[model samples]
Target: MLAETDIKDRYTSTNKNFWFKNMPTCKDRQFGWESNNKSVLFVNHGKTTLVDSLLKHSGLLGNGPNVCVMDSNELEKERGMTILSKVTSFMYKGNRINIVDTPGHADFGGEVERILSMVDSVVLVTDATEGPMAQTKFVLTKALQRDLNPIVVLNKIDRPTSRPDEVDSELLDLFMGLDATDKQLDYPILYASAKQGWCTKSLADAQEYIKNPPSDSQMGSLLDTILEYVPHPESVGDLDSEPFRMLVTQIEPNSYLGKCYLGKIQSGRVRVGDQIKALKPESGSNNQEVSKITKILLKRGLLTEEIEEGIAGDIVLVSGLKSASINYTLCSPSVTEPLPFVAVDPPTVSMSFGVNDSPLAGREGTQLTSSLIRDRLLKEAETNVALNVVSGNSSESFEVRGRGELQLSILIETMRREGFELSVSPPRVLLHKDSEKNLVEEPVEEAVVDVDAEMAGIVIEKLTKRKGEMKKYLEVADKVRLVFEIPTRGLLGYISELKNDTRGTGALTHSFLRYEEYKGPIEKARKGPLVATGPVGTCTSYALNLIEPRGKLFIRPGEVVYPGMIVGEYNKDSNDLEVNPTKAKQLTNIRTVHKDERVQLTPVQPWTLEEAIAYVNPGEKIEKERRRF
Candidate 1:
């Protein structure tokens, strides 16, 4: 093993002043030090664009329409948002840098929490115009609590309305508000426009790059800052001599290689065919099993390349472990103690998933049996550590709990696309009992809303009626940012309403806070649902024309409807109203001149999976069909 002095000298003596005039060829640097830095790009503040630009500038991606490689899932592409944490790596100046792109939405906080354990530092991407958002605070808090080094990137500096100076100041204030330590307070900042594909260390340089078109990309400065600020794993100790140990952070099923577990090597080294033991520390010390490694893989660019051996500090994928799971430790047989694992926050919302029992159950989807649904849900729970599944009161239903409604909705959508049919109930906040106080507590969220100054009053009034308490309000130019502590259940279907109230210009985000004393009953602001209560038949334009005046219709003239199915939302009443949408106009022996006129029916509004889930109330279930509700 190298001495501590030698390790320190190795990094200090390397090419600290090297700058990339152009992309370098794939060759190892003569610096003898194996520098591998693992960093995570977190938050929704232009991380995807920055990641794509970095990969392109590194020559890992070719010039094109700037595809977001991290969001490879179909649903992610359709929604233009990330729902899962993805791993990718690139080589810069002969150093291997692993980057984990995590979900930015608060509902996927579980993904961000687990991946933080495997990364050494974080690149907290914040918007130049919006400054720190709700998700920005959520992820930054997690990174700070772990005492990880942070590098801030002020993205979208090229926007016409960008305010880098003010945003930078706000960022510093946020750090202080979060009680950051002296070391964390002193973070490095970079200015860039990821969409334009350039970044610089100083504001002047960024402005110059924006004014004068650079023949080559200027992302080298950001890469250099990362290598310098993020510490190498070897700096911890003589990790090469320690026993082989790795804590599984993520698990993915492979069609050809079975299950693949991805994690960072905490200590020692492991090679293909090496024998290892799987230890479940949370379950019990006696629950241990032996296994052999079949293949070792390392992420290169957007794909995984098989490697013969993996050393400490490197994130790798290992196969051939049949029973290994997340938070479990894979280590040398001689090592009995497992590495410490960070526990994620408990789920705040839950929904019921049951076998499709509607009349159209087996018409559209092929997988309709209860056993098939149960197996698929179990498989999902095995890899998704944040999600919990428990059997419901009957054999046909299961309660699925997660961080929030969006998270659960994404899972349901994924299952729907996979040819699985299931009924999903509206999301409900998971409540707890405070034993000492003998009081019931519900989950509360820290909500951040940005709306036009003119609409702020109505926004505040609406949220107040839902039991939301405003904690802080600030005016930014013509916009107002309001922070509130509100019950989780109060914000169930508020997104659509907020958009309507603000004319589609309002933005709102929230994150889990803590369980507090239950607030007294708050009246539901949502209107009643228009249920179709009649024999199964096709909808008629004559009947829908009359119902359009009562509320918005969800079905057109030719769509099929059945009893107990929600057809539309009632606008005037707050009680569930059953209407016969299948009723046809009585035929007349003699037709008047107006009777020959065509029926002028309003167009029906389609509901996405998330919208449908949010629109449902108690005792209402959204059926899974090829045609969305």
Candidate 2:
């Protein structure tokens, strides 16, 4: 067993083969983010919780004789999910390792791709109980394409129903299905319980450990496996000689430090105050600006240590670069060879973000002007390589395009929290031209749904109506797993409907499979909406009681209402009906004989932003929303 405290505290090693031992001598080496030699990228499909958990379980989060860096983003902490790629480092077995934690959800796939270019290898984390999921396949395909060998970690193996052997087989099938190379297919697998903080290379050992849990070394096998399987940075890059070059993978703004460009050094060495040039290959101007590096920060543990110089194959944060964008190469002035830029996955969904033109427009937010909205969007586009922001014909509107509705919704939620009032149009799929210049509307995705066997019929019916082709169906432990290749446009509001149909027991996962020709005229028609009538007023239970029998209500009593605002779903027909929610009861002979005279109203189905965006298409057209706010 490895000494956890020694591995956690004394990370720096004088071993000649250790990467950190090769750091260049320079002035002002107060050791702030000083460059570390080894780096590994952690890629998962939402299997693990904290990126630092694997290391922290081994006593790596505290003031280590080795440095630690952990996820500090407020949004990530709040959501309990990684919204962006986070960089952290730790020392193990006389080696310094920089860990890049990438988002697991497909919505943030672009972040995973960008971070892969900076590291030599990846740790592919998968859930043992669920096996390789939709996102697991998606992310694994990316890693294989990048030619990065993977070290698979079968996480959550301590679950009562975990089938490690079955999951292991499924993973093999996935690798072969994705056409992985033989070397990649022969990947190493380890069993772990990230929550329990123990891992073992052998399944039998893991089972034994579960019976008598080890208290001393919680995650030694994982660290050892990583060190054994993941190659050293020297094997991936030319550390001996090359100009100082790095492809900026992320750009972050700091009030005190201005703009900081974070990436791994591609070649040579860069010292603080070293003159570096920023090159934009896509800008088409051959324009380059020479600037002096003011500060260099490196990954130590959970925090960054200031370093004077950074060598090749090390991830570092460099300050003094202005307007630094993703894929921009920061290199020595004499270095002309630019690194290959990572192609951004094109946007499939678009929504118009316009100024809040409702009756209560400026009442909720301060940043309501088009100029401020446009500036904020442009700033986001600079850092978020996956997003596209283009101005609409009208000054008040800007079209925001992204991978999916969830991605766009996250942006909207972030802006709204920042006091920005905006009316978002219904999401529309962006059309693309195929190889023959044929008009293509959207990409087709493979949606895999698992639900109670009894509820499978309704799910199939719903999906079939949405132009989905059922590919396979299987029964597993009283559950039915159905696979369908469905059009992306049809899935916009399908989540809410699926939950309703399955009584919240269904699980759905989808991934972009391929782009196909326009599937013309998918039937998206449904019943009409119950709209609010006339002028703005407050809703009352008296009116709600009368309307409860006709449809489902979205508004509660005393809530502010507006004309044309959809209050509920009209269950009767396709025609929209205006209802008087502000109507008061007649005073004469209106007293009820029963005590507790509160009007009994059916519980209203509250609509979230995603649900509201999906429900308001009046004509079933794949365009903007017709419901007025």
Candidate 3:
């Protein structure tokens, strides 16, 4: 057990950075309580800002972009959301705490699902104004299923419209709805303003602290709470007696180390020179490859420290394993049995990635060959367990399946940024056959939408036309909360439409429910594309100006166009229109007395990777070249 010391005495006002700077040295701490404990912080969709703020205020991150240190990917930084789980450690009162920051988006739920198994406790960060959201329920359910008790943090409490009491009550109801056990229902709540770098046990204290600045940091309360509630790894078993075992949860490539496998030690200890064997538990094969550990790296404040040995419950990075992959068991050479691995939800969406057969395919990107694309995708699948790649009908294309459109789009966007030019087909839901019922079933998702009351009818009507069935509807204040169970196909291109209908004030999130009977056919009365028909040439402003009335243009002037290329959406009618966007205005010597009419074209609305993937119809493909959709 840990000692009960005065929280005030442990913290100091000597400097504003006392949160991390004033930590007790290893020499001053008691012997038994020095062990490290792991905890995870997660949020619902797009709520990573609170986690980033907490890390920055706690001194684990530095000043720069307004993104979490864990979200190191360029795309994640640009989007201001975490797409992967990241590990970092800090010292609080002479105790080491390993913190795992997981992505909030449901598309990356695989990251959260596997990460929950490595931590002993969870810190669920939620917006006070928004309360519990769709993804909040998803992640909380995963944690609850793992039997991990959560510590609730009502983040963004400083918002003017925040209602902590109401949100707190809603959280209780959410817990009850999830069928949480009695111990789980009695969760401790913290009111915090991660932006302001303060947290308190009560809403009044938090509000009072915000009004009057505190000289010392208030983040200690959170750290102290973890130490008090979260148990150490040794609590599970006697770590010193068991043989070494660890289940690889993450894999990353290192320029120097080749490949690094990350996971928490489940039993005993491992050193740099220890020999371990990688075993695939699910493969049901007896084959095992032995490898010697070269290095054990421990995460320390966003950086890793070379450690000689790692004990049970310590999340560490081990290198020198050439073929170790996610979900593989790394154990002592003497141990034969492997640890049980958590199963990830199967992918629900799939898309075909084919060689860029466009006329200008090889002009911009260096990697345009099908073989290179195949190799890159296979390498990604080795690390990203949630993604699966299989051969398509043709030799030049590969079908990639993943959790959702965002997951597949992120993969495509990442490949594009890496100089890989590939033609991607529109996303399609993966279907399943119910042999017992003798019925064809498709993937259904539970969508939770929060929008203004006036726009609820529009959202409902649009969704209903797509074969959506309303599950729940409630009016809260000036907004309406709607729940619907809709086929995944109906939601392919609906996100943008939802935003347009709500004027950008609505919040929408969805998660996979289960396979249900097909809901007949949903009408897809979408407009056709405008194809380029003339010879390849530079698009002119005059031609675009004249073509604006026919449809919405995807390209502006000064862009190169080729034959058979899709240039815009044909809005004049449902049939595809072949127009000459490259037709330059006639250069005539005769000049009229009247000034020439200026060509004013509508600004092109750019399509994000997800929107572009969702917009294409069957037999149509999105050409990814020079960042152009």
Candidate 4:
């Protein structure tokens, strides 16, 4: 091997700003994040080791790449906003560790669900103090339902106040409470402190027991356990049973190939130029027919490398198979039985991705025409089965439904970055007719709230208005843990109020729950928004001073403002009022003695993608600005 000469050079790095012009590095020398995507591997070095070792081990000689899934954005780093499941690989067990790191937030559960179907198992990580929190329950429950065995790892065991024993028992109990079957009850537990960079399989060992010297540690044990325990699914099916088969999982964009179809090869073999019929989803059972595998691709670590004759179990990419979708079947003539498909959760939230009716609709984006927007949405629907786009007219808008706010937000954000200009309506729950054909609209979701005992009643009271029903209550240390089955409809706009009510000390977790019967207009909780009546040119401190007495402003001086644009929020009952934020103050030549000179404008109320989606009023809409180039 030409080792020394070949290893002469090393490198680096994108984000929401695919089209934006490259920004200069910040004053701190740390440039804001650029691009973000799922790393396609798992069980990274940091997956088992502490975070610091991940740095050292990945760079033992040269700069390394066995790093864990991370978001470099300041907001993501500080607040940990992983709205997507980022997959990455780590070298372990003499094999590549293909792992998917799911988000801790519940809103991103859709991302987690979509990615989980790709893996065979999951390591249920829990905090020693909090044990398996609500999100842990949400993710674990889905994992168990899919028959994926969970390897439990109690993290943060190094803290002096960490109660490992209690957390262990609680975790087991939580698993049971989630309707885990007898066979799923017993799971392996590992004590770990990601900061300490150590783990042990022994339960009798002290929670504080960690290898002090970092150089003395290794990831051999964790790797060995995964290799020994996690049974690799049969990559290719029985050779004699069929010719070749695969499941269409994800669709990728390629310049030469156009669309790259991602999936797992099941059986037989696929070679380039092989004649195979595309098995349409419409045909009856055992429906797959003849088509051709135009091209074959493989994943070399995080990058996609083209190949021929890929086997089963390994995640593969293919091209020339047009119309491939999540559940579509790809098989040879010799194969008849279609693979059982993994069904993603139905979307509970829906909103209209409509033409920008705002006066400045076509001003911001190039792809602002209705036909352009429709083409983009239809293209997305063709690939992403999870997204549903309802047909609408040129004057009307398209109704898009997705699992949650984050999913819809991602859709909007992606479209915006692609030069699309569209306004979105508020997200409403997608209701359905059960087998009985009854009108069963969804209710508020189940919420797990952790708050001080003194604040418990008020939290419950606020939840009650939102059609919340209690599941069970627990008292742990100085906190009260209560679970409630709340209706999803009334929960909208409640988060901000909840944070305000609890003084930002409460923890709330929620997931979509099965809908029973419809919950009547439970309670009407509404707030007014500051609407611009006339065309705004620019905000000024003097003009803002006059408008400040009316309500709060979203745009400070120097920021551009437009009519029909929501400039601020009014602190009052449900009522939208127009205000002139750009009215220039009538100047006077006469000067007065000694006075406070400057008037401070209120800071703009910057909204997160999800929050802005939620903040949309009934007839109002959300305007998205693509990262500028």
Clashing pairs in 3: none
Give the best candidate by TM-score: 1
The digit string of per-residue lDDT tens for model 4 on 434-507 reads 76675776745667777788899998898887778888888865678888888777666666666667787777
Q: What RMSD value applies to candidate 3?
A: 6.1
Residue 393 of model 3: what lDDT?
85
Model 1 off-target regions past 4 Å? 1-44, 234-240, 586-596
The residue-by-residue lDDT of candidate 3 on 6-41, one tens digit each, is 322333232323432333322111101100011111
Listed in order, each prediction's TM-score against the native is: 0.90, 0.88, 0.89, 0.80
TM-score of 1: 0.90
Clashing pairs in 1: none
Backbone clash pairs in model 3 (N, Cα, C under 3 Å; residues 3+ apart or in different chains), count: 0
State the RMSD for candidate 4: 9.1
Ranking by lDDT, best first? 1, 3, 2, 4
Better model by TM-score: candidate 3 vs candidate 4: 3
lDDT of 1: 0.78
Q: What is the C-alpha lDDT of each candidate?
A: 0.78, 0.71, 0.76, 0.61
Please give, for residues 148-251, the per-residue lDDT of candidate 1 as tens digits. Answer: 87888888788777888898899898899989999999899999887778888999988897788576556899889877887665442444567888999999
